[model samples]
Target: MDVPEALYLPDGDGFTATALTIGPWDAAHQHAGPPAALLLRAAEQASGIDGGQTVRLAYDILGPVPVGPVQVRTSVLRPGRRVELVEAALSAGNDRPLMRLSAWRMRSRGDAAPATPLTHPAPAGPEESRPERAAFFTTEVAYHRALEWRFAAGTFNGPGPAIAWTRPECALVAGETMTPLQHLLVMTDAASGISATLDWTRATFANVDLSVALHRPPRGEWLGMDAATVHGGTGAAQCNALLFDADGPIGRSSQSLFVEPR
Candidate 1:
């Protein structure tokens, strides 16, 4: 079989997941990134939201999304001239939703004042970094392989915080160009795994939900994350990341984790 060039292949009203969607933890399931991006793509294409941009996105992972055909349904939850709420759901066949996303889209005032001066300086750009692979990637063809990773601060398997730059090697869907938010969303879901503090072999830390808030549309192909995970001993954990582009800081992302010993 030939390897797919994109993460997903369009199928009717749904999409077919390719090997590129597989995560490090499972070959049969998909990493949250691609599916999240798909949901956002659906929302962005939905009617009545043409003039606005998504400012916030929250995802609830109901279950492991199987690596196969999945349907995406999007609707406008609350309509407004200045702001709107959009919802999207992904499901396999008639099964319950595997993931659900709610997004807030707001109109941009092009006449607004300049953005506040960036307090924290930008991290080292991708040109100043070296390429590295994630230590936890066990599968030959997985989501990890779909991105180009260049670390500016920490290694993939190293404990504590990490600062890294990532760019997608392929499109989210074949024949489609990914928007800036889609690019950022596809990389933000890995914040917890890349910045894990627990031993990968001894324990499992999987994020149950992901939320992102952006102050401005990210620019450029490379997106940066300064990420860290905090485990609270009681089987619950939180991961946070300051999102960036080559120009400067753009937003923040966070995930709620379900931690357990293997």
Candidate 2:
């Protein structure tokens, strides 16, 4: 409805912390916190139990994470009964690791059977669609204004490779409610920078790594992102995604872009 009050906090059993502040669209020189669902809310506040139900989520970008004071160290690593596994690490002091995660917290068992009817290719409804605020990418336009995007073709002006269809005007927190896997990692990396090239003046990218995988968690919240940008020249690039939640295709995310040339 109107959420955004979990800047990450909770350090104890297993661990859960977030202060290495850096959000004006993040990418603090590269990337630190506040995205990827604030490291899944510091792994659901070290899995203290709240909106329970994730199934599986993993992340590893052990490279660029520097801004100031940050810590997240969760641990459960499998306590199956209804399935539970947690392992997080986002240190920023020791300067050794940057990000590492492992999730699979669950406790849902209510499927009556008789469910099979889904479709895809429906992403242009944000009142019609008007996403192109190119102002030299002001932090990717304030992180795409927190979602509700539309660009089912390719035209962010430059970089190359794009296909959009996001949704998240706000709705993802666990301690209360709403958990479509935290908006599927917040729009699954929002259509990685240009798939090929359309001349947005040139191109520019920076995203060391990212990974996501879910397959039967979402059922609502109109989620569906079929991204691309499979490869880029020299500088370095790679993006791939396939996540839908309209009752079909549950998840898949990948990123490793780092292009440059503007």
Candidate 3:
């Protein structure tokens, strides 16, 4: 069998997180991004589409998903002709839940209506951009190595707002065509990293959940995020992003963050 360059290796029963999927802390744990995208893969399968596009995805990171063998199960919670809601759960063993997700797939109403209020302009293309190789390029995790990043505005692993163009350099699951939805979902988690508000040394912020809403299926392979992070005095932070395709604005994403002193 051919090797996968992306996040997971597909097995007979389920999939396993590779070295690329390692989290910020340890090699044994996976970053929320790749695992969340994997949940979308399962959700898309269970959605039964009937005809709609996946418009929204919400993921709750139940606990640390140990890096290695993991099983994902997706089911339709609410089924409809015009709309469908599907959910996916990731478990490693003993039925212990690691992550849960809910996705909404909605079909076009065939109404002659204008789409988004405004389409955000995409930044410069990735060709004119630079790869992120900062001092914070600490480890060579599978997820970091698996993606090709091009920064247009801000710097990654820094304290500032950022606009970046991103593309998955590898496959999500072996042999499975990485769908546009899967591509977009994975990038949403990186929004926080692209636009960080706190010092990584003094404080650590890990997202507890990710939520994304798309107006339409993105066109082209490259995706972009005009991302920002806001910290509250109370111990919480929010990462919000305006999502765009190579063409124009498609949707938005948000992450709830848990902040702590490192």
Candidate 4:
């Protein structure tokens, strides 16, 4: 029998984050990536743009979101025929704010916008890449098991810049189909982990914000992040990743980090 995937079990307007949603840093804290995807889900629902494509995804993590039940509320900030802006907020118990997210969705251009050439080609396929070491993450993380990862360059949680391709090991929500946009959101938030510029043993590097800009929606089940991180002496850092599908570059994602010595 296959292991159950670490994803949400929808409960009305809320969802429960399972063991697979655990983060590497804190046992009680959930990973920012999964919540970010959930935020996108709520935003997409509010936008009511079934045929729309996400052009930008922004996430502001206010604090560590405790694992367990959480609720999402979404609203349309700006309505447009060709474009729309939607916002979502994730709250923990007692409706405490944990994260705020915004997305810009636009009608598909189809052929109006000519296809741009790929500046970054697809890296090695998932079969050719290596799995991240088990010891790299101390605390059990849901993403580690929920997703399949293959590194293209550098080392897994090893050091400087690296590239890793990833795909969902199982559904993000039990019995629910996840969209391409949702998959991209989850993987993009891992920019810092994919490439670390700081020592994990001596420092805590957490992303406070995440932003993704896509020229076109990603295609294929496999998505990759060519990532790099930079840390300043002033306890601040940032990670950037060029995202790709199996074909080629699809978009880009970035995160602002909070770096502090342990």
Candidate 5:
């Protein structure tokens, strides 16, 4: 079989990370986006989630995930017909879990009223946006090459809020089709970096956890984020982003950051 030009390749029971999974911070470690998407895929496939839709996905970063073979373990934490909680963890070799995902799934009610229409207007579409490269990256990186980025407002080199749209050029896994949730998860982790308020050379702002809440599922291949980071006086910060698709607003994502001088 031909090699897959994707973020990950399926191995035995787990998947092996490709160079596309590398993040801007470290070439040896995988970006949170790829792993987050992987965990969500596992959670969705786990038993007891067949009839339900995942409304919330929260991830805790235990450590830096190395770019190599990793395994995912998933199980239903709380089982129910209408509501359920599922957990998935990613680990490499004999080391402890690098990341853990807790997802809440809810079954849809046919007789329930329709969802409230979103009034929030979307940012400029991808066609109207300009192509931009992240200034923090000094050398060629696989993660950067794996996705197409366009800016509607602000910039990757600027310090402030930003509105950007992105889509993966490659699949998440070798032979599997990426779902809409998986596509959204793959880009949500970059909200902090895309809207950095601090200089990248002066200090480092790393997210410890990521929480995403979706009122409705996203559609289409492209996803947009109106993102901003707020740094406190203490060694803490938060990155908030409103997620959107080609249609309109779909959800929101937040990240709790750990700030420190480099």
Candidate 6:
């Protein structure tokens, strides 16, 4: 499927979205339907913001989104004078909320006050490394054409840290134009958890909650992700990542994951 067309799926109703189940995790795809991406699009469309502008998107996965039909409902929390605040919830049967998201829409204020560039060095590009098919990446994630991902280090057996590079195939979805934030959101899942990537051969991981923050828009189309699972012991794990553009680091994302032995 092409990037634009692949980003969303068709519900039995007129509304189209990404199906609850797609490649890799077997769970619903994030930012697919009733996901963060859908919320952002609905807000933009409602507020009459051309999908090309900048809007901050955040998602809180309260629980598993279940595999089945879903619907998205959006509300404008506060249509501010300078900024617009919007909230979206995804529900299955009876409108039970599966995911709740809020977006901050505002006109670009341009660059921030000048400061020294002290970000970390850029990681190696995906092209420099050899390509390998991850069981999750190729089958579950459905990222085949959207990104050129390479697992820098990790065993296929168990939970642990993993590194990979991601570059978007298409811009992002917002009406008629693509935005940089869409690229960041699409690749945020590249290498999620540490325990899940370990070579132990008997661990499983699923993101319970995830969020990404962008400091500056991506300079180039290609962005790299360096991710690690930090400290999680009591049935929970946290995955953190730094996003890098050609110039330097641009954003970061982290997720709280549920861990168990398969």
Per-candidate TM equals 0.96, 0.32, 0.92, 0.94, 0.94, 0.74
Colliding residue pairs in candidate 1: none
lDDT for position 101 in model 5 = 99
Error of 1 at 212 (Å): 0.2
Residue ranges of candidate 4 with Cα displaced over 4 Å: 1-3
Residue pairs whose backbone atoms clash in candidate 5: none
| Candidate 4 lDDT by residue in tens digits, 1-262 | 3465657888786889887777778778887888998899888878766688889998899999887889999889999878999999999777668899989999986679678787664457778888775345655555567777788787766788988888887677778777777888877887798788666778889899999999888888888889999877788988988988887888888888988888
Task: Sort by lDDT, best first.
Answer: 1, 5, 4, 3, 6, 2
Cα lDDT of candidate 1 equals: 0.88
Provide backbone clash counts, one per model.
Answer: 0, 9, 3, 1, 0, 16
Ranking by TM-score: 1, 5, 4, 3, 6, 2
For residue 194, what is the lDDT in candidate 2? 29
lDDT of 2 by residue, 1-262 (tens): 3333333343443223222223223335323324466667667677744556665666777666554345666677776656677777776656366777788877655664655566654455434545653333434323434445566655555555555655565433324443566666766755564244433346556566677766467767656666667544577767786777655567677777666666
* Best-performing candidate as measured by lDDT: 1
Candidate 6's displacement at residue 158, Å, is: 7.4
Question: Cα miss at 47, model 6 (Å)?
Answer: 4.4
Global fold similarity of model 5 (TM-score): 0.94
Return the TM-score for candidate 2, rounded to 2 decimals.
0.32
Q: What is residue 111's positional error in candidate 6, in angstroms?
A: 6.7
lDDT of 6 by residue, 86-131 (tens): 7878776656787777777765555757745956543456566546
Model 1 off-target regions past 4 Å? Answer: 120-122
TM-score of 6: 0.74
User: Cα deviation in Å at residue 55, candidate 2?
Assistant: 3.2
RMSD over all Cα atoms, model 1? 1.4
